[model samples]
Target chain A: MDMRAAVFRGPGEIAIEDVPKPALDAPTDAVVRVTHTAICGSDLWPYRGQEDRDVPSRIGHEPMGIVEEVGEEVRSVAPGDRVFAPFVTSCGECEFCRKGLHTSCVNGGFWGGEDGGAQGEYVRARHADGTLVRVPDRHADDEETLQAILPLTDVMGTGHHAAVSAGVDAGSTCIVVGDGAVGLCGVLAARRLGAERIIAMGHHEDRLALAESFGATDTIAARGEEAVERAQELTYGGANHVMECVGSTGAMNTAIEVCRPGGTVGYVGVPHGIEDDGLDIFGLFMDNISLNGGIAPVRAYADELLADVLGGTLDPSPIFTKTVDLDGVPEGYRAMDEREAIKVLVKP
Target chain B: MDMRAAVFRGPGEIAIEDVPKPALDAPTDAVVRVTHTAICGSDLWPYRGQEDRDVPSRIGHEPMGIVEEVGEEVRSVAPGDRVFAPFVTSCGECEFCRKGLHTSCVNGGFWGGEDGGAQGEYVRARHADGTLVRVPDRHADDEETLQAILPLTDVMGTGHHAAVSAGVDAGSTCIVVGDGAVGLCGVLAARRLGAERIIAMGHHEDRLALAESFGATDTIAARGEEAVERAQELTYGGANHVMECVGSTGAMNTAIEVCRPGGTVGYVGVPHGIEDDGLDIFGLFMDNISLNGGIAPVRAYADELLADVLGGTLDPSPIFTKTVDLDGVPEGYRAMDEREAIKVLVKP
Candidate 1:
């Protein structure tokens, strides 16, 4: 069988191509019909030529869909079950997976590697039992509910991981660095974790407003030293918890600078220019600022975040400001990269 | 009156010179006649010409002494009280201090600046009530008790900070890097915190032996790649809690390399060549390793560690392998620089 999938040709180029449709290649694998997918800020890295990638690579990772077929070993989801997989697939019982570090699972892999691209009609999930999350059948046809929980496959769980790493607790103050979907999700996650003061730093006025609605007590559209000063002034020195959603060296430094002594900076930002510039580690060591977080173990947090979404208490759907079909994925990438869209959702 | 104090003549030189005796300089000041002091690994930076400093400057910060005089506002101790001061003098009531970040206290200053050098017979204490911790009158004149508590002024407290920063918990495993007095004390601290397994890494055989007595379950004196391999082999990948007590760039890298995913590296090492070599922050991010710790908040941990010391469960005094009188201050520097002594104890 053949299916339409988004393929990355090179920088600034994504194309729709007919690729082999995902099938249950292993007993632990399940084939999914992707009803929804998303264009992430991370995707823009390759599109903008900031990160290197092999040409003709399968594109996209976040996927929400129906299980088209499941292998004999896939027990959790049956055909026609509405399911979503995390950014990475992993064997449920690996030492790391058992310890909630699924990102480091011994048998884990990304969606666009051996599996079909997420922005496709069909995708394959390896280690299906450990990777797939089933939504209640009652919400199978609910478009509103599906839209609300789509970000949970990546950004929401990632934001929650940032909050957890930063030690955001009841009555704690926090500063979220970035204006992207993940950063907005961080504000929501901080709120969910009972943070009393969520100060958001971003450059977009519209996004800053969105952050406030997402439960940020304050928002500042500043960069560099000014951003640090404003955040510190608001927190009466610096916030104890900071989230770095942007991977730039400047964002990392701001996250650290706005973190108070004995505080923590939870950074889920994938390093961009860090290899070239390095981090101000001596500064981090001197100030007692704990730098925590890396690639979020998004799978480990799925159940809890899904529960919140199902309960109708969490809504991250507003981040999907643009919608597209499989053919629109190239445009989706362009929209996100040009800041014309906060995040683009694809209905395949 | 004049007091003999150790002064930094430059790299590879320490000279004892008579300086005017310290007196109460502020309303909160206390003048202490030094009874005991010790050389810190940090002090060697200037002695080895690794760190820049003004020549002929006063040296030494850790001091245990008898309070000879007190200004009117000093409420914690009166004349004739036996006390010890942390490396940095902080006004305990400051925002950072009240939260147990005394090292970042707004009114904090180092002992050898403005105040008198701790290596001198007399040193003036600023923010006396907040900076000085008094020993019980019963144990005041006991030589054994005095020696047992002297390291609390610096190394012991420092090691304790590392354990706390590393989040050492009951039934956890830990790896302490370095064989200095602080590293030995870190082994003790981890044991005190109920870590089930403690691995000590260093280059010295005698110090590793000391670490064993201090509760290290394993000791590996390897460096670089071999060090990482041996530690990983012993720890089943890597321990979740690693304490970097050695300030060298190589030690920091080893600490990071040996920390497991979702683990933390509690670094108390005053970074030596990090500015030049830089840290592999991207690697840390990729591994999900958290970097926690800075200059230890020694004063913040004094009370709890002191109680443990007085309870006969902890004995870190063994780290002081050699003791010298006031005139042996120059030799004390040489012995530590040459690693002839784990730490040098000075009595004036």
Candidate 2:
């Protein structure tokens, strides 16, 4: 059988081409017919020629679909079930997975692993029982509800990880660096976690409005020292917690500078050009600050966020400012690259 | 009045010279007659020419003495009371002080601040009520008890800070990097906090033996990758907490590598030449490790440690392996610099 999927030819080049249809090759695997997918900020690393990539490789990780087939051993999910597959797959039984750090699961791997990617019409997901979360039958045909739940695969969960790592809770004063989709989600997570005050730093007036809507108490459209000064002024010194969602050196430094003594900075941006000399170890030590964070364990947070989505308590679909068909995946990447869209969703 | 004190003449040079005796200069100040003082690892930074110093400046911070005079506003201690001044002075009313982060107190200053240094016959102490802890009268005349209490001003307290910041508890498995006095003290601190297992990494057999005496369950006589491998082998993967008492880049890296996913690295070494690139941000983020710690809040930990000393529970005096009279102050620095003494006790 043949299927249509997005393939990466090189930097700035993505194409929808004919590819082999996915099949349940293992007893723990399930094949899902792709229904919706979204572009991520992380995808830009290779799209912008910043990271090397192998030509003709499968692309994309976030996807929601209807399971078309399941191996005999797959007991939790079956054909005809609507579901969301997190960016990473996990076995659900490893020490790390059992501890709720599914990203570090010993036997788990990324979606585009050897077989194919999620941008295709069908995806073969391994560790099926542990990797896929079932969508309610009530929302099976609701496009808006599906769009709202799609981001839980990566962005929403990543933001929640940042908040959790920084120890954000009731009465916490927080500063979020970056105004991207993930940064906006961070504002939502901080509010959900009961932060007393949240200051978001971003340059886009439009995104600043979105951030305020998502629960940011204040916004600073500045960078570097000016941003630090504005955040400090708002918090009366510096915030007790900071979320760094942009991986640039300046963004990391500004995040550190705006945190109070004995505070924590939770960083989630995938490091690309980060260098050792760009960090201020002496300053961090002198101020007694903690630097904590890593890749989000999206699989661990999926079910909880899906609950919020199904309960109608959260609506993250606004992040999808643009929509495209599978054939427009190339233009979707370009739109995100040019900052013309916060995020792009695709209906296959 | 004239009093003899240790004065820094230049790199690698020290002298016992006559300086003006200290007097109460502010309502919150007190004058202390020096009884016992000790050298610190930080002092070696300047003494070894690794860092610049202002020549003719008084040298020394860790000191225990008898309060000879107090300003009318000082209500905590009066004339003739035995006391020890924390290395850092803090205004009790500052937000940081109220949070028990006295090291970062808004109105705080180090020991050698306008007043003459602690290695003198009499020294002026600012914020006396907040920085000076009273010694019980029963142990006032015991020289051995006084020696044990002196380290509470810096080294012992710094080690305690490392343990606390790393969340060390009864069942935690830990690692202590560095074999100097501070590292040895870290072993003691971890054990005091009820850590189940502690692996101390050091190069010297003698220091390793001291680490064992201080409660290290295992010792790795290796450095760098080898040290990390050994620690991993012992802990199955990595330790729950790591104490980095050496400020070198390699020591910090080794500490980070030997910590388990989700563990904390408590670093208290005064960073000298650490750079940003030396850290593995991608790896740290992926593993969810936290880098926490800074200068010890000596004032905050002083009273509790003093209780241990008076109750005959902790004996940190073995760290003071060599003793020097007031006139031999210069030799004390030489002994510590040459590694001929673990620490030097100065008696005036």
Candidate 3:
């Protein structure tokens, strides 16, 4: 049986192609029929040729779906259940996983390549018992609730990671870098974590408005040094917690500069220019600033964030400015790459 | 009318010059008679011309002495009392100082240049009440007690900073990178913090033994990759806590590679090669490794460490492998630079 999936044909090209549907390849695996997926900011990396992607390669990692079949060893998730998984799949039993570092789980792997891409109709989840999170049975059919929770599969959890890693807490001040989907969610995460002041730094007006709605107390439509200087002035010589969600050298530098003495810069953006520009270690050292976070272990944060989503206290659906079907997957990529869409939500 | 102080005449040259004695320059200043001070590894930076310094400038920072005079505002110490100050001076009442980040204190400054070098017969202490820690009156004249507590002015407290920054705790495994005085003290600090296993890495045989005496459970004499591999093997994969006591880029890389995912590398070595080599941020990001700490904020950690020193549970006097009087200061610098002595104690 064949299923349609998004494939990278070449730079500036995404194609909807037919591929063999995934099946239970291991005792701990489960085949999930994807009901929801999305084109992430990172997805644009390969789509724009900023990063290399093999021709005809499966793409996408975010997935929220229904379990189609479960192998004998799959216990926590069964067929017919509505579930979601983080960008990275983990056995959830490794030492690192036990400590909430699922990104470093010894037995975890990413979706795509030999495995079915999450942007496909069906994908096999490795370590099903430890990977899939069920949405309780009642809320499974609620479209509004589902949209609110779907982002928890990636961006929302990741944003929470940035905030948590940066030490955002009640009554504290937090400045989030980037205006991307992840950064928008970070503003919400800071608010959720009770940060009294949330400063969002980015140059987009529409996105900045969305950020304010998501509880950002202030916004800086500036770039580079000016953005950093503005953040410092707003927070009175930098804040104790600064979240770097853009992963570029400039963003990292801004985060470091906007961090007060003894403060922390929690960065989750996939580093882009570090190989050439390098991080400012001396500047960080002299100020006694700390560098924390990496590829956030999103699965570790799924539970708390999902609870908030289900409780109606948190919603990040506003980040999805465009929607598409399987046939529009190619356009989805184009819209996001062109900045015509904040994030593209897919339903197949 | 004049007091002799160590002056850096040029790279690789030290001069004992008769400089004018310091007096109370501010209401918060105190003049101290240097009874004991030590040559620090960082002192060699300017001496070797690795870092530029003013020619013929008064040098040295580590100081433990008797308070000879106090400004009207000096409340923490008085005339005839013995006191030790950290390399950096801080007003204890500042927000950073109150939070134990005295190095970043808004009202703090380093201990050289116009302030009068610590390696002098009489020098002034700025913010005396905040910068000076007074030794109990009964133990002031006791040579053995004084020697043990003297290191708290610098190395011992710095080592404690490394350990504390690295999150060393009871039953944890810690790796101390370097075998310098600070590194040896780091081993003691790890033991003090209750680390079950302490690995000291360096190529020096004698220093390794000293580290062992200070509570290193194992030692690796290999350099670079081999050392990282050995540390990994010892910790099964990599340790959760690694103290980087060497400021070289090579040492920083080793610390990163030897840290487990979700672990932190607490670094206190003055960052030396970062400008050219830069830090491995991508490597650090890949493992979720956190880089914590910078220049040791010894003042922040002084009281607790001093309590242990005075209590006799901790004695770092052994780090001072050789002792010299006022006239032997130049030779003291040469001995340390040539590795003939681990650290040189000076009685000015």
How far does residue A120 in candidate 1 sit from its true spot (Å)?
Answer: 2.9
Off by over 4 Å in 2: A52-56
Q: What local distance difference test score does each model get?
A: 0.90, 0.87, 0.90
lDDT (Cα, tens digit) per residue for candidate 2, span B49-137:
88788987898998789999999899999999999987888888889999889988998788773587887777888888988889888
Chain B structural similarity (TM-score) per candidate: 0.99, 0.97, 0.98
* Pairs in steric clash, model 3: none
Looking at model 2 chain B, report the run of 10 residues with the lowest lDDT sum.
B273-282
Q: Please compute and give the TM-score of the first chain of candidate 2 against the native first chain.
A: 0.97
What are the chain A TM-scores for all the models, listed individually? 0.99, 0.97, 0.98
TM-score of chain B of 3: 0.98
Question: What's each prediction's TM-score?
Answer: 0.95, 0.96, 0.95
DockQ of each: 0.61, 0.63, 0.64
Quote the lDDT for B82 in model 2.
93
Report the poorest 10 consecutive residues by lDDT, candidate 3 chain A. A273-282
Fnat value of model 2? 0.74
Model 2, residue A64: displacement in angstroms? 1.6
